[model samples]
Target: MSTTRHYINLTNSLFPLPGYAADGYARIKGISALVTTFGVGELSAINAIAGAYSEYVPVVHIVGTPSTLSQADGMLLHHTLGNGDFNVFSNMFRHVSCVVSMLNDPHEAATLIDNAIRECYVKSRPVYLTLPIDMVQQKVEGERLRTPIDLSFPLNEQEKENYVVDVVLKYLHVAKNPVIVVDACAIRHRVLDEVHQLAETSGSPTFVTPMGKGAVNETLPNYGGVYAGDGSRASVRDRVESSDLVLSIGSIKSDFNTAGFTYRISQLSTIDFHSTYVRVKYSEYPSVRMNGVLRKIIARMGRLNIGAGFKPNNTLPAVEPESSAQTITHAWFWPRMSQWLRPKDIVITETGTANFGIWETLFPADVTAISQVLWGSIGYATGACQGAALAAKELGINRTILFTGDGSFQLTAQELSTMIRHELKPIVFVICNDGYTIERYIHGMDAAYNDIQIWKYKDLVAVFGGVEDKTARTFQVRSKTEVEALFSDKEFSAAPFLQLVELYMPKEDAPLALKLTAEANTRNNAKA
Candidate 1:
């Protein structure tokens, strides 16, 4: 509602900037805004905008266009089509965005802008607005800017909410073993506190999907591991599938999220809590949203039967005491990284190996994990890292870390320079595995299409306008010992300046979840 000017880091490409806005919104818990020029600039960033819409991040896209007189006169603007139609680009955004507003009229511009942003927040999707050149200078009422937009959701009807809560309680009271499965929308809709209270108060085994990595506190006693049907660890999968009731919160059952539609839980045994509705065993209650319903359920629930519900097995698989001389593998790297992560650190993972590999990581309390699991956009994490770092800096949260693959990093590597210009310090790990490992798993294991040119990734800091020892530093860790040594280094761990590590792993190596998901995808593709 209220706008403030933050530091804008200009980048070479428009593609990654919207990604920055997406994660910035996540970190700051508010709608993030980005501006683009008409047609070309807006079109270039549409992919990222669609990714935001897919992943439920609220972003406001303001586009600068030609003056209204020019449009009225049918003058062909350089960025527009030859036919002089300026609405074409905005039309394309309608499919992805929840709201699109064109500010051709100066009188209604303020109201349109406010309503657009409100819709963006309420729906947790992107909104598109266009401002022409002459309209930009027109005097609008400053009185409206004094009051902030009302971003609160409409209150659920009291009778319907109580009835829904009562029905949910009935299920809870009679159920012997009920488990909670948190997913991506729980984070997107800002319902973590309600989710945490429900999980802790109910004492049910709580698990996260791959997309819901950091939705709940992992250190809790009832914290089960990530559940993605067949892709899950055997103990976790069996525990969830055998449960009498499953409370699925804010779930997005995408292909990768559900391990290619392999979820075994039946609708009869499941209750779904979404942003706008709540479902209990086959019956759904519309206009009964999750935030209030969860809060009411926790309040009304006096006791839970929870008979013989298995305790969460949070123990990481034991590995042989690794030496610095040993080669770094996914099995060793992921579990070790869990130990390295600090509380409240913001960890951003790329859609390649890091996204799937992160399922093994048991995050400490308040750690924020950001990734595009549903959208599955490559090279998004790097640009998101910049925006997250900026938001982190503003909020006084230290240590924004990024884990990206070599191939994916190359797509938006220029954003690193933007971080350098803004003097934001983040620990970046570029997993140099030679090619697109995820693609290799699904299709060709050794095909030419999967290969990428090798770059000295460590040299990128200097190439991107970063000073060697003052503003930035770089390192290459080839073995487990090297990784351990770097992690143990006080200077590196302190994250005083921008740091990039070329983390070398085998080209053919992949996380367990990725392998399982790839196999499922392959089989599904062969079906029809």
Candidate 2:
């Protein structure tokens, strides 16, 4: 057996090497199932690492911490050095990770690490393993070193097969108006083939949750548009709510994505295949293990005499094409966008008017919409665009396009530095309204705080150290003709280009998002 040594020389030594290497490792591998003591101060790096591995990538994160002695002694920390240190980092990751464990004994480290990896890979979620600094130097007796365990395929095979067959049969036999809601899990599980097969064989209309926007090639004929609050196509929403069976494969009912639990589908009739549990809400379906279940369902579906639904009636309202704007309307901006897009374009939308408006008005099967729905973080669009663009580049796909409100762009515009540094050219379409249109409309807050300091967006790209000729470029468009000309231009399609198309959207344009925001504010104000 080949053996290797990890010598931990100093207290701070571990931090710089393993800790630094861990981030790089995760970025390269695109996942983290291990946890480290690195906290919020390390967030930008951690998020950058996590973002690098995001969307179905399994990462094993292991965080190292000060020993129990340091914690008990209450040592002031450099990285938010703290008393009760373990809990501090644990809490920080709780929201973002699938599972977390703090390792107290060096002997159990191997087992814990194995378990974390197994869970992360199986669930396709970020898992964390925290090692106390004291454990780092502990020696394992050569004889006592355990055999490396492979926790891969933890699910019982026969049982998993049976479960998959059963679900498939259920879908084939029972539900009319069946729809499949794809989420990030579908991609992580590498189940795109299965999803396409199910969609094709079942001939069921498929709608992607916001996170699952590109789960299936949006170009498919059966592709129903995205289903989110006001963004949902009315027919798709009706079909989802009214369906006899809603197959929510890898979909999470997180608050942000669901518009605060607005959809009316009873959890009972829903068949949820998650990373951990297989839940059938209607029959009080006993939650079972996930793996073989899906396989079995596919097998059973092959034999079932289920009738295919009629060719999907594309009876949905035509998204009113943005008539070439004699003047700017949210409606006009999207159609111009739709006209510009080719198949396989990646479009990232920030949260607010841009998300609510542009996403609803235009339907580009090729566009990949990226947003932090669970967090609803405003500035996330820009950072997420960076990640999406990097993902596109790594996959050798189309250059990404980003739509950020003038307000939202300012929050993480610094990420433009990272974009330029990486030589990722994304067309940043900035809707230059003067204020936070969503907030102003929602709260009826004519508040001055909602108004932001404006910057000439096209000029800022150069200020952010973007290369003039090869790396980035910018544009400001006031009228529809200008927008259309940019869309039709073949030369702008090339990489390492940043086109900042500036549009003077009226504060009144995003009525729906504004209205929802106002109602939410009223309720919040009432609660206060």
Candidate 3:
């Protein structure tokens, strides 16, 4: 863990963050630490921690409690629940926490801290620890910290690997049209290399879920488009559904990830390779780790001649439309932006219109796309952009790009201050329509409730601590010609420092897929 410091400090500590923080953790492949004050801070952060627990993301929440003397005297603290008991907050965290600890005694503090960290990594869940002011500097044995934490899931029976591999290879040999479906957990499990090798070795078409977008090199020869059942493109839906066999790696089948359970693949011909288990057809091999199996599969790729599977058709064009009629519609803008993306750029898309529109983009090679698909939380992208930019900054990679709607940006726009504070530079493209366009498509198309006040987006950075030309700059483009010209400009495209672009289009402009999905969700919600 880097001990430098966190990017931003929320005044309320009630920010919408579980998804945002988890978004960074997924990309960095490390534990995220969220610090807070005693009762008020802990309780405010509890829900986000619980969300992390639900999604199997590792998070360590450290809370600063009252001093030992105050707790010993049972003095009521300002942030407390207004009672004598401090144990109430700790006990509440226990229900959602994988491990809970309070550092009151020095003798046991080291063990408790080590065990908490170990459990969090092992289970990939959240842990809670309360540190009293008095115990902050207590001395403990340094030798204990030298021992490495064990993360290996070793199988007791030596035959388990051989048995599972033989069965999987046997099915692969006979499968005519095998397809690889890479999900979000593949990123969390850190098997993207294996995913690439497996897809290439099998000579099969590869598709990524929304949560797993950019996990694979989308420019691969056999790369297919995003496959979300009815939400998918026409060609993508047909090709994926027609596959004789589906190989799901680190799969997560949440409602939003699966387009509200619209996937039509049969379990009888599906093979599921999870973190700790593998399922072939209806039979499952318990404790069979994917980490080992992926290595063995990659090693034997040359001998298997797995190219006998179905050949994929490259349906997505490099550039679909060369000319637009001066109007910026979803179909026109997405394909055009696809041409604008560059390699090594880290892109973050907001929920609603940006998320749906991004699905239509063909990312350049080595680009990483970040989104909160399952969580479906608005205002998440701005915070996630800050974290991802910081990660990219740490990696010495510039060109952090963001695509967001105006409504979503307003919810968490304060995080822009954090980005400026760190001297981090990211290009933010704000889609400026007049209202909550996504919500209007879902429920009320023209309801008064959906409207929001218009702000001078180009002037926002001045209020948010940006010094134009020196540290920040903003642009307003209302037409396709103007937008294209801005992108083509050497100065704007360089993205030398922080930049924001306010893109204006019609209020009703949205991808057709989001509209359909929203309609389905509205119906589903109405039923209940």
Model 1 spans with C-alpha error above 4 angstroms: 1-13, 18-21, 24-28, 307-316, 322-325
- CA RMSD, predictions in order: 2.0, 6.2, 3.2
Clash count for candidate 2 is 28
Model 3: residue 425 alpha-carbon error in angstroms: 0.6
Question: Candidate 1, overall lDDT?
Answer: 0.86
- Give candidate 2's whole-model lDDT: 0.61
Ranking by lDDT: 1, 3, 2
Instruction: Estimate, for each residue in 1-528, the C-alpha lDDT of model 3 and write its tens digit.
Output: 333323323333656453365445445545667777887767766766666665666777788889888988889778876777888999998987899999899899988987887677766777888889899998988886566655544543558887787788888777777788898778766678889888777668889887788888878877887888788887778777887778888888876677766788999989998887989999999888786787776676454323332333333344434554677777667766877889998989887788887777888788888777776667777877877777777777878898888988888788788778888889998999987898898889889988888878768789978999999989988888897798799888888888999988799988867876787777778885
Clashes of 3: 0
Give candidate 1's error at residue 336 in angstroms. Answer: 0.5
As for TM-score, the candidate ahead, 2 or 3, is 3
Q: Clash number for every model? A: 1, 28, 0
- Highest-lDDT candidate: 1
Per-residue lDDT tens digits for candidate 1, residues 308-407, read 5445432445653634338788877887888888998999999989998988888888999988888877888898898888888887888999999999
